[model samples]
Target: MRARLGGLPTFVLLVGAAYCLFPVAWVVVAATKSTGELFSTTTLSVGTSLLANLGELGSYRDGVFWRWMANSALYAGLGALLSAALSGVTGYALAKYSFRGRALIFNGLLAGVLVPAVVLAIPQYLLLSKVGLTDTYLSVLVPGVISPYGIYLARVYAAASVPEDVVEAARTDGASELRILTSVALPMMVPGLVTVFLFQFVSIWNNFMLPYIMLGDDGKFPVTLGLYTMLKQGNTTPALYTLVVTGALVSVLPLIALFLTLQRYWRIDLLSGAVKA
Candidate 1:
């Protein structure tokens, strides 16, 4: 029974992997097909048009797809960076400091986490519109900079990772709070902050509704919104379907590259922490 139970988890994990990877596998296979072959061929079969599809995607609408990619990179990269910095500072403060209304503030953040972003989109749009910032890059970027979930993660991680004794010692040595945060606590919180950055990056990259509501210019649309437009257009011009598939495949590469690169840091940080502990 023990052996059977041990194998059960592995079976479940395999099933989960398949559930997640099957669609990705399908996209990979489908991207290789030409428009003519897309429906006629088997779902997983390879075709000859992968290069042609890529060339067409590049030339489509004066290469608007690449512009979408660049926009996504800007939004995700800058937004995640700002969010990580803010979350790290706020989280460290919440974890380390005692002050009036701290509990209330943290609880509010918790409440914010429970609230769906979809619910806030319209209000956010109205606020931006009041500032004449609607349909601009700032509109999409400003809201992503403050992630409640990221802040909560940072708070928890800071509490666990940063030792009070160490903080006290730094204070005793006459380091300012800012100095200590930058020089001490942040180093310890690198892994957690990396996690926060990655999460916020992926969230911003894949976000649809916020961009949909805020952006009027196709030129400023992120890859997600751009692909959505392409998918919509594909309904009328079916050949664009191949381009959409190819774009989807291409759009995913950056995220995959990011994960592969950052995962190394996560492992190193985690392993170093384990060794120290």
Candidate 2:
């Protein structure tokens, strides 16, 4: 019985792993091929044009790829930080405090999470344009900071991780509510907050529609939009395929590194949350 049960999970695990890694494998192999070999050769057969492809991509528009990467880092890093802070505060408040309209606020934030990014893109662009904020860094960063899902995660983390007795003791010792939140609760919530930050970081990093709509200038484009524009043009100029593939390879690196490094924190905190529940 044990062996059969174990084999069942192993088979499922292999299938799931293959489903996830198949695209990554395809991208890595396809990226090594030249334009002529792309459709001509087998999808997995690597061509000898990787270096030349990289060189051509580098020379394209005087190295626009790096600029887009930097812009993406700015948006994701700063935006995630702000999102984490807001989520921690708002989540803690909802979990710890009793007040009127709390359910209303929580429900509203939950609803906001279900709203698609494409739905807000045009309206956000128009609104920012009206205030002369369109085409600027603030236009992208500001909207990104207001993540509803982050708040929801933050509330869950705060409630699960933070002990009510600890909070009561801190209050009895005359710590201000803000101080209890900042020092006592914040430290306990670190793992969950990191999870929230990572999620928001990826979301904003992968986001294309909003930035594409908001910015007319190429300089301000995030990696996703920048790669997409290259892709769109690549349909006409198949040479841009090299840049698109190489850019995709580069863009995926940081996220992988981050997930590997921080995965332990997630596991540990997750176990803690589960025990509390």
Candidate 3:
């Protein structure tokens, strides 16, 4: 009887999956088409010009497309790593320690999470400009290193996942606080930190406004802004449409690779700090 009733839920899930994936499937198919075929062919039909499109994208603007990719990787990768590290240490402190101003600081960081990024970005740009830092890589990177949500997640995970008794035992064995955090607490927090990293990584990768407002050099533009400029230019130069489409298809691969690589950490039980057996 349960098996007989599973069809409706299965149908609903398949419908949801298709709704999410249809655009991706269209992009995969559309990127393969030539300029003429792109407008001429059915949305789902495969075309023969994938390599040609890729070649054109590579040659565009003195191969600046690849430069955009590298900048994105640098910004997102470095920013996420730093954000995760800072969040881990900060979260661990908030979770494990009791000290003066601790609650006040944690509450302030929580309030920061409620404020939208757009609200803060303009002020950040203006302040950085006053110091002569705008338009540089540091302008983008420095702002991304602090994630209130990451800190919040880190705090929650540390409180719930990290064993207090294990920390006490390490201290009793003459381990320094720094050593205990690095060697013991961090390992226990891996699954949660991976979550923080992915969140920050995707947030930084897809971030457009901060870089758009901060950096003037095309050399420093990440893929999001790069593709936006391409699409904007496509209105005058219709050929750029193909490059944008192809670039969109290529850009998603890194995120997919990241998800696949870090997915195993999610399977580890946060409470038990072990893989389900």
Residue pairs whose backbone atoms clash in candidate 2: none
Q: What is the lDDT of candidate 2?
A: 0.86
Off by over 4 Å in 1: 1-9, 264-277
Error of 3 at 61 (Å): 0.8
Give lDDT tens digits, candidate 3, residues 1-277.
8987889989999999999989989999999999999998888999999999999999988999999999999999999999999999999998889899998998899899888777888999899889999999999998899998888778878887888899999999999999999999998998899999998999999999999889899999999999999999999988889889999999998998888888875543334321210
User: Candidate 1 vs. truth: CA RMSD?
Assistant: 3.8
lDDT of each: 0.90, 0.86, 0.90
**Candidate 1 versus the native: TM-score?**
0.92
* Candidate that scores best on lDDT: 1
lDDT per residue, candidate 2, 1-277, as tens digits? Answer: 8768988899999999999999888888877888888779998888888788777767779988888999999999999999999999998898878799998998998899788888988888888788899999999999999888788778778889899999999999999998998999999999889888988998888888889899999989999998899999988998788779977987898988888888765542333342343
lDDT of 1 at 177: 90
- State model 1's lDDT: 0.90
Per-residue error for 260 in candidate 1, Å, reads: 2.8
For candidate 1, write residues 1-277 as lDDT tens digits: 8879879899999999999999889899889999999989988889998899999999999999999999999999999999999999998998889899998998898899787777899999888899899999989998999998888878878887999999999999999999999999999999899999999999999999999999999999999999999899888999999999999999999998998888854432324332332
- How much is the lDDT of residue 136 in candidate 2? 95
